[model samples]
Target: MKATDPSQPRERALLVQVVLGRRDRREAEDSLAELERLADSAGAATIGCITQRRDRPTPGLFVGEGKLVDIQLACREGKANVVIFDNELSAVQVNNLDLALGIKVIDRTEVILQIFARRARSAEAKVQVELAQLQYLISRIPVSRKQQRFQGGIGMRGPGESPLQLRNAPMRRRISDLKRRLDRIGKRHASVRKRRPWPLVSLVGYTNAGKSTLLNACTQAGAYVDDRLFATLDTKTRLVHVPENRKLLLTDTVGFIRHLPHGLVASFRSTLDVARESDLLLLIADAADPGIATQIDVVHETLAEIEAEAVPYMIVLNKSDAATQDQLDHLLAIHHDAVVVSARKGEGLDKLKARIVEELLAHDVHFPGENDHG
Candidate 1:
């Protein structure tokens, strides 16, 4: 999806989700909640939501015709100008939904790419995100053109006028150009990494999991932190001084989310390489989230996808101040060695630093941060 144009009116969005088989209703609802956060991050005002239970999505429109009608009604009553789905939609499905609902229709992948595009600041990030967005559009060019971004140009003018190959030529050349640019950026990044002397430690976690906040607390990096999804798209690296004047290179990376678009992951490979090459990974998570376990698993899955799972990691359960004592105790019992800390409140950071020392030095050396001020 294209980034919302600031000059245009704010988009009011109607969210849609489908529950398959006997899947947990709560899980689907939680996913919808996260989608709402994504919509909010994209500067869209979510006005309503629609959910359906089905063994599988209908082939063409995704939802059944009756459900489609219901969605149209919701859009009218809610005054929504857009419909965002929690499910992945085929190009045909997106086109059909757009025509049926008489509004912009984008799926989860589009929404995520839109967020990444909007939040990207650095030149490398901008290239990476633009590449990903183009790659996503490449698959849909033959069918869907309502995204408005592809509304102009050759293949985007509609599929039938020119031969499919001819229509695809311009987009193909543009994609190749973006990839070449990204490759140069990647090589430069690698050269910088090779010259850095300190051992690098990377922070990885679910979106909005306080990774940025923790970076700020630990290194005073003044990294951007927001209570919204994908707030930090570019990695922020800082020199972290542990006790005894020993130094470690720490970085806060783009946070992971469930069902992260494969195109987005491939495009961000250069940025996420910091994780795969790190001396250690701090797999931080929100300790208070009711779905904490699932979120942690999602992070693990993403690390593996990026081939960062081999890097030794220590779990730092953040947001302890917001969790009940029972919740903390239960998590600690399960993730026995995990450190509990509240980045917002500066609590239990000493223990986390001590653990980092042990992990980094390959011995049981302890830091003198036995309290909040590590």
Candidate 2:
């Protein structure tokens, strides 16, 4: 088992996706397309993609033995050095696939973890990413003796121990250490929040929905903004001045995606506590994306999982400058009170700020103020 050299050429990747029973064909295609984008984000050149319509997944190979053979052939023809599946693979499936395909076998969860590992900058974020990666690895200890020989690759590297070291008690001890560190950090964050006098507002949205740009527009926080998926993994907070000399704490968090890994959600609980504890949620959505509706649903589902669904939130239809009139109308129809804005051009930000003030005032009127000891 050896580590891959960074100076070596990028791997050519072949993507595999399954359209399970009763799944919409269009949605399946869109999911596969997103997987391709994820592969690209992780520095892989996507040579080709293979999809199968199956009644259900095969227990051992996931895509069935016949489909697996086809994928192997596709990998050979495409000269692909790796195969990425759009669905999460069980330990058995991954082991069988690696043996049959004779290449690196990874899933959507691993792809996302790789991107998170690369994007994490803050210490807290790095800890969270490492914890999630380790948790995922613990569940993926290969059953086959030959599969255990697989070395570090794109999805295997993390902030801490190597994938090979994660097969035993050392990995458990590392996980415990990470948990304790994160618990300490979380308590510090909680104490800081307790001392803040201003009301809290958090930005929640799908990846590349312009939340970072909006944060820059509103408070000039100057967060690193990129056009790629999961570009902003660290949580950023800034003081935002509303009307009447009032100020509120605005926090930006990692974006949500369809089929987000459960391990990530659990590991990032502390970071997402900003959303759960916020006085108001500024739910941003990309108005220009055709899949905006589905994206919104995914965000809502994730928020619910974090117990943030009960919090007061407003839908923000961002990227208005790039959105068509029809698209805006459709979103407005779905979320009757959604605020429309273009965060990149700083369009409609004043109205957005005003709306924030209005929402805060409304919230204060309904709930007890921080100063009210009663």
Candidate 3:
């Protein structure tokens, strides 16, 4: 058993989604739409999607046994070489699904990790993503010979560093080593922050909420703007000059999602510091998304975990062109201060910019330069 080579040609995938308990059919459909975006970002064409309603997932299979069979059939019909589960599957479940389906089965968490592995640009980001992949692989590596397709490359490569075993002691030591390296990166990040006086503004929200779009609109960043989940996995920073003589360092980091892998959070802590250190958080929400509330909660939960709740924030409801009037009214009713904008069309961006300026000026107590420090 060998770890799948990312450099190999893309594999067609069948996305399987399991809906537990009572959930709105429309909402579930929307979630699958977002999942498709994630799949596309990972260079996979989604040939089929299966949505199964169940009280709870089976212990061995995420979906019911009947639905799992259905999914297997669908994959065969679609000629999909890989099966992607919308929810995170446990180590055992992944193995079971693969055996039963006779094809590669990967969970949402693993898919996201693969995207991060591909999109990671900086050396630091590359190191961090690889470490996360290793951690995930370590957890999923099975003991039985018959139940493991994730045998190699999970914890093998380093970013021009030493290699370690994927299994036991070596993996543990590598994890420790990565943490120490990230600690050093954190110290340097802090030093850079201390030397700068410009206010930092972080764009955060659920995946596919247009954080990258807003970043580009404001700063003319030319950063890749895709209508997909986690399009901007690496944190991108650029200078923006807003109204009222205000200047800020706007940063777009990885987007949040419900049930985001814990290993990713831990591994990407260094990248998350940009958000933690920000003076203002622009919590972008998709105005047309039905699960906006749940998305907001997921972002807040992530912020709490990262200890970034202390930062003042402004809610920016984006994609106004696509939002209905009723949706607009509902959003305003819930968040009165939120500025509505279409990041793609450049609509209402000025108002959003003004509000950000207002927030920054409210905290605009300045000290002299080092030469004139009192």
C-alpha lDDT values of all predictions: 0.88, 0.88, 0.84
Kindly list the per-residue Cα lDDT of model 1 for residues 10-94, writing each as its tens digit. Answer: 7899999988889888889889999998998887989999999999999989999999989999999999999999999998898
Model 2 per-residue lDDT tens digits across residues 290-334: 888889999999999999999999999999999999989878887
TM-score of each prediction: 0.89, 0.88, 0.84
User: For all candidates, what are the clash counts?
Assistant: 0, 0, 0
Where is the poorest 10-residue window by lDDT in model 1?
363-372
In candidate 2, which residue pairs get closer than 3 Å at backbone N, Cα or C atoms, i.e. clash?
A: none
Off by over 4 Å in 1: 1-9, 143-162, 363-374
TM-score (C-alpha, index-matched) for candidate 2: 0.88
Using TM-score as the measure, name the better of candidate 2 and candidate 3. Answer: 2
Judged by lDDT against the true structure, how good is candidate 2? 0.88
Best by lDDT: 2
lDDT of model number 3? 0.84
